[model samples]
Target: MTFAAQVAMFSKLAEEKGMVNSLEGNLSVIDRQTGNIYITPSHRAKCLLTEEEICIVNPQGEQIGGTGKKSSEFFLHEAAYKARPDVGAVVHCHTPYLSAYAFAYRDFETPKDTFLSQIFGNIKCLPYGAHGTHEIHQGIEEALDGRPVALLGGHGVVCVGEDLEDAIGIMEAAENYAKTIAIKHKLF
Candidate 1:
């Protein structure tokens, strides 16, 4: 699939999952061969993002193409890409249930469900850092440590994968697992 289509698909998925409302989350894709990064723009609603709204940045974080301003969180994507050369795409979102766990400083244990286990592996919690700051980017990079997903304290979650679809699937699985855990906790 084209990069634009993947961006649109992820935007819609984020909206559908309520992970992002009005541009609260970001998605990025890296061209492994060329080191070009494509990402969603800041300030645009995720549900309404179009192909043109995506921004292209080089490995150095310089905008080379596309429309709109790159997300302030572009540094987070850059840091992750630099740390994990095997990762091709990253998805970051303020998923409520997961963020709740983060805000509470509770590590999200792997859910007992087989599907969740198979998909999410284990999600590690990272220290709190200022949003859009280099510190937060570094924190995420450290948290990755070869893991596919990491929960940012008092912030959100980041999922990295070999491509856009894999990244999105990880995010979706994490959120679903978090939601299920929240429901079960409420019941007990």
Candidate 2:
């Protein structure tokens, strides 16, 4: 898919899944051919977003193109790319189910459900850090290891993948597992 289309797809996913508020969360993908990153704009409602609003950044985290402002948590995406050279896409979602685990400073215990196990082997929670800061980026990268998904303590969830679809799928899996865990916690 076109880079703009990819950005729009995941941005809509974030909204459709109720993973973000009006201006929350963000998604990004790196164009391997050009080494340029296309990301969602900060403070823009994903459902109403257009392709032109997606921001572009270089490998060095410098904004190189696009008219919209990069997401405020752009550093988080940058850190993921820097730490995992193989990661071509990153998604940060404020999905309530997953954010509950983070807000409670708890790890998302990998669910034993067959589907969850297959999707997220061990999505751990990162140590606490304030949002929009370098510390948050460091904590996320450290917790990420080589995994596709991790939680930002007291903040939200982050997922990295080979592309926008994979990243959004990871986020969806994280939310489902979080839902199962929440149910388990409530009943037991």
lDDT scores of the candidates, listed in order? 0.81, 0.81
lDDT of 2 by residue, 20-105 (tens): 65567888888877878898988888877788888988877788877788888888888888777888899898788878888887
Q: Global CA lDDT of candidate 2, please?
A: 0.81
Question: Best candidate, TM-score-wise?
Answer: 2
Give Cα distance to truth, residue 101, candidate 1, Å. Answer: 1.3
39-130 in candidate 1: lDDT tens per residue?
A: 88888888788887789898777998878789889988888888788888998988888888889866788856677776566677888889
* Model 2 misplaced stretches (Cα beyond 4 Å): 111-115
Using lDDT as the measure, the top candidate is 1
| lDDT (C-alpha) at residue 103 in model 1 | 90
Off by over 4 Å in 1: 111-115
Model 2 lDDT-worst window of ten = 137-146
